[model samples]
Target: MTQTHIGVDISKDMLDIFDPRCGHRRIANTTAGIRRWLCGIGTDSFLVFEATSRCDKHLVAGAAAAKIPFVRINPLHGWHFAQSLNLPKTDRIDARMLARFGAERYPEPTLPADPARSDLAALSQRRDQLKRMETQEKNRLQDTSLAILQRDLRASLKALAVRITRIDALIRDHLRAHPQLAGQAKLLRSIPGIGPVTAVEMLAHLPQLGTVDRRSIASLGGLAPKARESGKFKGKRVLGPGRRHVRRCLYMAALAALRHPHLFGNAAARMRVAGKPGKVIVIAIARKIITIANAVLRDQTPFATA
Candidate 1:
C-alpha cells in the first residue's frame, strides 16, 4: 500500500503545507492548525520539518502527540533540494520541496520524549539560559561604577546563581527518579575528567551508546578526527561536524586530563617523542577520551585510568 507524504515548511509565524494532490496551503503555525492538519494522518505518512535557528519544539511535540513519524531535517536540505531543481526561492516552493523530500527521502525519525526526560531537559536549558544571561550581565559591570548599580548587578548574579542551582537540583532529582538514566550518568562520571554536567550530557545525548557504530558515534558527537589529504600531499587531522555540545564537553574534559601527568601528559609526551606536535597530541588525547567515554557508556563500566 502506498502511503501519502505531507511536507510542512515552518517559519516563526507561518507554516506552508504542500502535497502532490493539493498544491499548497499556507496556514498559521499554531497548535490548532497543526492538530487539524494531523487528523487521520497515518504513521506511514512522512511528516517532515526543518530545524530552524531556534528549536521546533512545537512541531516535535505535535508529532509526538499525533503519533506521526516525523523528522527535522537540516534547513539546508530544503535549500539544496530547491537548488537542484533550479527553482526560485519562496515559502511555497520550499514547502513543495519538503513534501517531495518527505515522500521520497526521509531523515531520521525523531524520538518522542517521555514527560520526565522532557522536564529534565527543559530544566537544564533554563539553567543554561540563566547562566548565559548572568555572564552577559557580569560583563556589563565595567560600564557602571555607581555603587547601587554595582550592588544590584551583584545581587542579580547571586539570584541567577541560586536559580541555576535550583534547576540543577531539579535535573538531579529527575535523574535520580529514573534509575536507568541515573546509572548511565554514573558510569559516565567514572571517567577521569567527566563531571556531573558532562556525564549528564553523555546520558541525555548519547543514550543508544552500543547501537551507534563507532565512527557514527564519533561523528554524531562531533569527535571524529578526519585526515586531510590532497593530490601528492597528506595534510593534517581535523575534527568535523557532529554533536558539537558533547564534543566540546569531551574536549574540555580532555584539556583537564591533559594537565594531569598520568592521564594525558605522559601519553602526549610519548607521541611528541615520536615527532607529533603538541597541538596534534592534544587533539589525539581528546579523541582518546571520547573513545573511552563511548566504551564506558556502552559497557556500563567505570572508566579505567590509563
Candidate 2:
C-alpha cells in the first residue's frame, strides 16, 4: 500500500491540515479534535508539522498514541523550504508545502519525548530566567544611589537567588528520581570541566548528545565551524546557528576546563602557540568538551584523563 503524507500547520488556536486525498481543511487544536483526526487517518500516514512551542503537544500525543510516524521540523526550515519552491505563505499553503516537503525529503521520524527530560527542560529554562533577572537587578542596584531603590533591587536579587536555588534542588531531585538521566548526568560530569549546572543543561537541552555522531553533536550544540570557500579564495570558517543555550553552557564548561592541564588545557595551549585567537581557542576547547562528553555518554563510561 502507498504511504499517506499528511501535513499539519499548527497555531495557538487551530490546526490547518492538508491531506493529499482531501485537500486543505481546519480543525481545533485540542485533544478531542486531534484524536478524531488521528482516528480518520490511515495506519500508513506520516505527519509533518513545524515545532511551534507547546502548541503541537496534542497533535504529537495523538499521533504517537496512534502509532503514526511524524516529523517536527523547525519553522524557519519549513519557511525556507517554502521559499525555495516559490510557494505563497498562508496556513493552507504551509500545510500543502509541508506535505510536499515530507513526501520529497522523507525526514526521519522524531523520537518520543521523555517526560523526565521535559520536566528538567522546564526547570532549566526557569533557572536561566531567574539568573537573568538577578543579573539585571544587580546591575540596577549598582547604578542607583537612592537607598530605597537599592534596597528594592537587593530584595529582588535575593528572591531571584532563592528561586534559582529551589530550581537547582528540583533538578537534583528530578535527576535522582530518573536513574537513567542521573547516570547520564554522572557520565557527563566525569569530564574535567563539566559541573552540575552544565551537566543538567546538557541532559535537558541536548538530549540527543550521546545518540548522534561527533560531527552531528557538535553541529547540534552550535560548535561546528562552517567553511567558506569559493574558487581559489577561502573565507574564514564561522560558527553556525544551533542550540544557543547548549553552546553557552559548553562555553562556560570550556573556560572551567582551561584551569586543568590534562583535559582541555594542553589543547588550548597548543592552539595558542599556533597563533589561534583567544575567542577561537575558547570555541575550539568548547567543541572538544562537547565531543568528549558525547563519547563518554555514548560509551556509558566516566572520562579518564590521558
Candidate 3:
C-alpha cells in the first residue's frame, strides 16, 4: 500500500505542516492540537519531522498514540535536503522540502521509546546538563581574579556538585526499579571501566545497542570512521555524526578502560606501537568498547577476557 507523506516543521509554540494533498497550514504545538491534526491522517501515513530538541516530543507521542508511522530526522539532514532545491528558507518551505525528502528517500520509521526508557532518558539528559553547568562554573572560577567573584563561583560549583550527586543517586534508584534496565546495566558494568554513568547513558540513549550489528552500533554512536574520496583524490576517514551524549559517555569509558591492562589497555598499547596518535588510539578504543558492549548485550552475557 502507498503511504501518504506529511512534513511537520515544529517550533516552540507552533507546528507548521505541509501535506502533499492538503498543502500548508499551522497549528498549536500542544498535545490537543497535535492529536487533532493526527486524527486527520490515516494509519498508512508517514510523518516526517526534524528533531527540535523537546519541542517534537508531543508530535512523536501523538503519532505513536494514533498508530501513525513517523520518523524524526536530524536538522542538518533536513537543511541539506532543502539546499538541493535552492528554495528560500521558511517554515512552510522546510516542511514541503521534508515531505519531498521523505517521499524520495523512503526512510524507515522509528518506534516510539518505551515509557520507562523515556523517563530514564529525561533524567540522564538532566544530569548531563547539571554537569555541564558545573564545569562552566568551575572554569569561570579559574579565570576570576576578584575575591568576591571567586567566592560566588566556588559556592555555585559546590551547589551544582551536590545537585549532580543527588541526580546520580536518583538515576541509580530509577534503574534499580526497572529490572530489565538493571540487568542491562549490570551486564554493561561487567566490563572494566564501564561505570554506572556510561551504562545508564547507553541504556537510555542507544536503544539499538544489542539489536543491531557491531558496525551499525559503532556508527550509531558516531565512532565509525567514514571514507572521504573524490574522482582522483582520497581524503582521510572521519567520524560522522551520531548521538553526541552516547558518544561522549563512551569516550570517557574508553579513557578509563585504557588505564586497565585487562580491559582495553592492551589494545591501546598495540595501537601505540603501530604509531597511532593518542587521540586516534582513544577513538579506536571507544569504538572497540562499544562493539564489545553490543556483543555482550546481544549475547546476554557478562564481559569475559576469554
Quote each prediction's TM-score. 0.84, 0.97, 0.95
TM-score of 3: 0.95
Among the numbered candidates, top TM-score falls to 2
Candidate 2, residue 227: how far the Cα is off, in Å:
1.4
Q: What is the lDDT of candidate 3?
A: 0.91
lDDT of 1 by residue, 1-306 (tens): 666677887888878878676678877777877777777456667677787854466667777887888777877767888788898877887887888887777467766766765566566667667878989879977788999999999899899899888888888898989987788788877777778887776666555565566777777777777889889899866787666667767777877778877877788889988998766776677777767777776776888775
TM accuracy, model 2? 0.97
Q: Worst ten-residue run, lDDT, model 2? A: 261-270
Residue 251 CA displacement from its true place in model 2, Å:
0.2
Looking at model 1, report the run of 10 residues with the lowest lDDT sum. Answer: 203-212
Quick one: ranking by TM-score, best first?
Answer: 2, 3, 1
Which ranges in model 3 have alpha carbons more than 4 Å from their true place?
Answer: none
lDDT of each: 0.75, 0.91, 0.91
Residue-wise C-alpha lDDT for candidate 2, range 1-306, written one tens digit per residue: 767889999998999999998898899999999899889888899999999889999998898889999999988889999999999899999999999999998898999788889899999999998888888888889999999998888888888888889988998899889999999999988898899999989999998988999999999999999999999999999998789899999999888999997667788889989999999998998999999999998899999987
lDDT of 3 by residue, 24-73 (tens): 99999999999998898778789999987899988989998998999999
